[model samples]
Target: MAATKGSLSINSENIFPIIKKWLYSDHDIFFRELISNGCDAITKLKKLSLIGEYEFKDDEESELKVQVIANAKDKTLTFIDNGIGMTAEEIDEYINQIAFSGAEAFLEQYKDKTNEDQIIGHFGLGFYSAFMVADRVTIESLSYKEGSKAVKWECENGLEFSMDDCDKTDRGTKITLYLNDDSLEFANEFKAREIIHKYCSFMPVEIFLSNPNAEPEYDTIPESEVTDKDTVIETIVEEAKTEEKENEDGTKEVVEVSPATTKAKILKRPKSISNPVPLWTKHPNECTEEEYRQFYHEVFMDYKEPLFWIHLNMDYPFNLKGILYFPKINTEFESVEGVIKLYNNQVFIADNIKEVIPEFLMVLKGVIDCPDLPLNVSRSALQNDGFVKKISDYITKKVADKLSGMCKTDKENYEKYWDDISPFIKYGCLKDEKFCEKMSDYVLFKNIDDKFLTFKECLEKNKEAHENTIFYTTDPVQQSQYINMYRNENIDVVILKDAIDQPFITQLEQKNENVKFVRIDAELTNTFKEEVNEDELKEMTDKLTEAFKKALNRDTLDVKVEKMKDSSISSMITLSEESRRMQDMMKMYGMAGMDPSMFGGAGETLVLNSNNNLVKYIIDNPEGENTDLICKQLYDLAMISHTPLNPESMTAFIERSNKILEIITK
Candidate 1:
């Protein structure tokens, strides 16, 4: 055929620029798009071979693969695939026409005869992505059909193209990209390798990256080390090494301990950079614990071992296979951005796509490959479709099922991983209602005794002490005083230290209306108080409150006097649960500037133990010389126990403590 030139067939004159802007914001994605087109070509050829429509010549390359070559000296990046190529007419029909997909056409023609699970390109715009980074693009292709002639096509600025017959005799296709000034970095060998590793690490076909301008690197290996998938450049022999050794009984002998010594051959083995088959594609029974760990490490590059993993494999309703790893995260769950890589037919689409991955699952490291994903034109995001919701719901159900199953069958390991995995489960509960319902029974709480128990177990165990009330401590060390009081009464208190626990407990309370979560310092229940005459107790409280108010010099201070069974306790602080929750909600919503006391009397009440010696002395000598110092010291001590004391208050307490020490010494 003679050389022919024409403009690209498209409706809009500025389509190319629109494609450059809208197809993908990341220009480097052109690498993924072009390579995906190559994979699709190979997949089409494989379908043809399977149905006997095409035959591979004995001398041709049998193993299908994609090769990427970066030539820095020429400022060009090339992609070569030894799969089905295109004819002249086919190129005109597919390449000349914008938004026309060759892969989709081939699949339609062979719809009944072939399985289209491995086809990666569906949008038909993948080939045009090359224009995003290249100044010019060229295509050289020779079809697999017999008697087909090789064709060459070139396009510059994506507006006009020229086609002609070429002398090249390659069986497949070769695409060369002339890197633009801004995209010159893609031509660097290291940069090319990095891009390929990012997108093609789990492609169905093996992908190899090379630098043609650099010196060829050769490695020597034995002949037996070469597999059918390896490419051998040359073979060489190995010299044998013989050493004389003494036997155990004192006899000296020369033995051939090295098996391949005399007959070994050095063979060159070329390795691909990608794994054609990832761990998720296999059946769960065929995988081991070590293999799961290895796959997690390889994909996530996280050295900390995962707590556990859920292998999702379903064929009916929709084909979805994945491995969701519960990573051992070091930071807060809200701040964590878990890497849940989404894939379509083993081709990476994006990470943490909320349309296909439940919002809560984003805090997990895993891979989900659904060949039936409904991707938009760019193949970068999911189209608004109901199918995507089914996938997300399926993943959420699978995770909830796995956790509940583990709690039922493997109680020990479930408890062992509960601390690290609780935040994730709690987050899921807060975000997803169905997941919360499914995981409600499996939630574990760690008590002050360092033992784990479920909500039901906690309620049942503490029914006699505080019915339907779950008392928890936020800071175990700082709240140890109140914890000891509860411990003295044999009342159980669970630890809820994480910020997530605030909303989580609230959710639990809403779900189970009868259940309540109270902070340990929220109230001094009757269980901790001694039975005394009401009139006498009321008179004592009135006198003590007046005396404390006069000494502390604060007229607005909330004071409560209680005769406690623990006489050693002098004073403590208590805040109403409603007031504290309101304050916490305000802070959570970023309204820290608002006065929390406006919602309720959020200011804590100073609880004075009437049985303590200090309270007795203060009530007896309200106007004594040292009464003011002792009352202020007791109030500071209570403040320190409730929360950290302010710097100024701490200094005053230190000075008052020294004065008391001086009085004691005198």
Candidate 2:
């Protein structure tokens, strides 16, 4: 082949400048791109050998290795790799042509049924990322094929490039970068070593740093002395005959010689920082308890042994491997970011993969590895790719399956984790429809009496009496006074206190058929089942509202007096479920800091029970002088039963109680 010469000619004179300015944020990535190409070439050669297209020499051990050498005096950084080097023709075709990738062509031709492991590179732009940090780049390579001569290609600013033959004996490629003034930092050995360790630690080949004076380890030993037993015995016998050893003053004793001591040798071992065996890459069944616990601690330094773990290894729609842990949720602690780490080929891409996993799954602490995730020209590119979405769906389904199994086999344990996992599950149910549908069967609802039941079970237990309505309370302590009221009527009120419960319930109500979730403290909760005539109820409601307004100053009692069934309570202060839930959510999202004027609202409504005798007496005896005092007392009692009352209002009520006490004393 007569050199197959070619030149890279672009339409615009400013194209190289545009590429340098807009395409890459950093220039060091160029090294990654070039090294990746070398790896890809080696991978292709291996595949060719497997298919009998190429044969390796008996003496030639083919293993890819990347070498980085920095010349501070020359302001040059060289990245060398011993892999399948390109030929003169390949240089002309692949190197001379900008934006044209051999990897892309290989994938386009063989991607349909080819093994992905055999293909590593995609875009040729990785080479260009180097331009971000370098002013000039030179390539020196010799084709891996026998009888191929070495070639050299040089380019500056991607504008003009030259290629020629060079005398070389190596079967590999070397990329030398002339660092720009701004990128001199990468010319240091320490910086280069850091980059290699970070980006290429787990690369297919072992990367060696050229350390000329590397420290050597050795063991220290002490000399041991050999003793002559006969000589020692003769000396001891002479000493015993010549002199008597005396102890203190009165008694004579024989002296004995002490043996010499010897020191043990101490050996030094090489330090290893890399975790060669990643936990996710291992078989779940083969992993021991100690291994999983150690891995969890290594990944999350502060977290204790996880409550439980889920090892997911799936290769269907996409290849995925991960070990997810259900960390013990400390109710007192707030949520933290970066709990789940996302990995590509056993290397962590980032600790915070919020986009990869739903925000609700943030409570999960684990690692996820997927090799098929697509990266842009730079491996640094991170976005919600198709494979990521598919993997997320798979994980969600797996979690639901696990929970469902646990619920069936271990009800008590499942219930114990329900409160801790409820916030995450409810948030997911409210945001992700697919997850919601799958998780609906596993979500457990706890009643006021601390009994756990699934949604379906609760509905079945209360469908006939409550007319398919599910009544829940946000604060069980505040709503306990009304629990007996509902119990007397054989109605079950679910206890839900999580900040996300309101929105979750609303979403559930929308999805469920003919189902409603009414708060236990909502207006008309006591009369939900009453069957009264509209006109007669309206008359009784109006009379009661007027009487209460007169007995208690209307400004002091912000209430809605309504007629209820004879069995219902006399008066109760309640908050609308939606209003309360919205407020809770607002606080959760940091919206509560706004001025009160922004909300344009007052306090919640007070529902007065007209059927109670105490309320009826206060209404009928409006002429009595103590009517206002009695009405205020009743209002305070209702407010206390519904929720914690305002401190100022409680103080005023206390003073009023003291006055009544004084009267009784008189």
RMSD of each: 2.9, 8.9
Report how far residue 262 has shifted in candidate 2, in Å: 13
Candidate 2 lDDT, 1-666, residue by residue in tens: 344344575434224443576665655555556656666776666666766666877745434456667666678887777777888778766766666678777667666646766355655556767777788989999877878989888888866777788876788888888988988888776787777655554455445554323343444333232222111111111222334577787799765564444433332322322343577887898899888999888668856667677898888778888888888766667563438877666544556565567777777888887778776555555665676677677888887777778888988888988887788778878778887877788899998778998888888877776677888887777787777777767788898887677778878788887888888776565444355567865665666666567755574445566666643466677766666655666687898755333565445666766667776776677657766777777778888888787889989889989987887799
lDDT of 2 at 354: 58
**What is the C-alpha local distance difference test score of candidate 1?**
0.87
Per-candidate TM equals 0.93, 0.71
What is the C-alpha local distance difference test score of each model? 0.87, 0.70
Best model per lDDT: 1
Superposed model 1: Cα runs more than 4 Å off: 11-19, 57-62, 222-268, 332-334
lDDT of 1 at 661: 99
Q: Candidate 2: lDDT over CA atoms?
A: 0.70
Q: Which ten residues in a row have the lowest lDDT in candidate 1?
A: 260-269
Error in Å for residue 6 of model 2: 8.1
